[model samples]
Target: MYKLQVVKELHSSEGKMILDVDISVQQGSFTSIVGKSGAGKTTILRMLAGLVKPDKGSIHSGEDIWFDSNTRKNKVPQERSIGFVFQDFALFPNMSVLENLKCVQSEKDEEQIKELLSLTGLTALSGFRPDALSGGQKQRLALARALVRKPKLLILDEPFSAIDQETRIRLQQEILKIHKAYNLTTILVSHDLTEVLRLSDYVIEIGNGKIVRQGNTDLFFSNEGKTDQFRMTGQVVDLICENEKCFAYVVVGTMLIKARVEDSMNTALGIGDLVVLSLNDFNPIIKKIKP
Candidate 1:
């Protein structure tokens, strides 16, 4: 088991907040941390990575002690055998895609490098620099680089936030595949609740620099009232008409969700209209507005 007990004080724009958390994670579990901005989600990941030290606490993985406040034993990032994927694809600007993966390796293993490049779909663009790759490609490179060391724990800090919806979904599927193939203990911090629900086996909710809740994904679904009646509100920005289908471009928060409109309600919706959108299983249902 991976055990963490932390008590730390953080100063933010709002004020000083205490982050006190006690959490235990089973090996090879995919866990996600969800919360509003500045809620210490990333901080937890950083602490686990050995980049940040708690004021008073200890982190242990089975028999290995990663951090212990009383003993003053805090292992460095390199010693922790952790793979971190940052929000900003922090690849070396001077290095090529292949070089980025090779740089982190403790030994020169050409076969391993080639395998990772193929796994991440970067074999075609292996010689390209970071600036030349698309957002999705760069993210794939980052994942490849992180996995180059074959880490026991994988940490991701909103790694998909910058990508488009389609690319984000694809990468999410890729991450799931990699996690299982590698049998890695993965921890992710994301603000996208839907993505958290889809990807995480265990979910941890953080607020005000503290852990608000932590449990299996079902517990989170129950707490969020996500029954069969899951609905969200958005504004109709534009309408796309094709063949026999009408798709409404709706702006929900920062996400522009494409929802299909029923024929009965097609003429009822217009630009700048507030609408309710629901997802029954995978099909989208756009509620008719009472205008």
Candidate 2:
């Protein structure tokens, strides 16, 4: 079991705030932490990963003291058995997909690395660099690299926030498969409420740098049911107006989709107007995306 009780002084969007969290996570279970912007969601994960220092408190995992303020005992990030995936992918721009994974391993395990590549569906792009891969591909590479450490705790900080909706959905499934295959205790930080309920066994809600609620995912969102609208931000690359109906071709990261324009004012779409594509029941429609 993993237990965390930490306090830290932080400067968030809400100004000076104290991050006080006391939480426990079960072994081999998936949990997600969610909160408003600047509520100290990422800070908690960073502290747990040893990337950020807590002002006080302790962190223990299975009788091991990862951090203790009173004793001044702290383990460096490498010492803690953790695999952290960041939203920005945090990949080496100069390295290929294979090299990124190998960089995290102190002792090379060729078979394990190959298996990770296959598991993440990156075998074909093993030789490609981060610049050559799509947003979704880079995120996959990031995840694979984290697993190279064979970590006991996996922390994800909004890892799918940068990807398109379609890729995000697929990657979510892939992550669950990875989590179960390794039997690792996983914790994810995401802003999407539906996503939290979909992937996590347990959900935690933080507000103003404190945990407001934490419980089983099903119970937390049982009354809400599924989400009605899914939105994707994309740039319009092509548009055609025929008989007062405008059809737009928008590019969302690596995916190109065609959408029917229907804005609030029924304005004509330009060739380069940024748009938001909303999907419900596989039918995607377009609207003006505000900056």
At residue 146, candidate 1 shows an lDDT of 92
RMSD of 2: 9.4
Worst 10 residues of 2 by lDDT: 220-229
Off by over 4 Å in 1: 226-231, 234-291
Model 2: per-residue lDDT, tens digit, 76-132?
Answer: 999999999998889999999998988889788999999999999999999999999
Cα-based lDDT for every prediction: 0.86, 0.84
What does candidate 1's lDDT look like per residue over 67-128, in tens digits? Answer: 99999999999999899999998999999998898889988899999988888999999999
How well does each candidate superpose onto the true structure, as a TM-score? 0.81, 0.77
Clash number for each model: 0, 0
On lDDT, the candidate that comes out on top is: 1
- Clash pairs for candidate 2: none
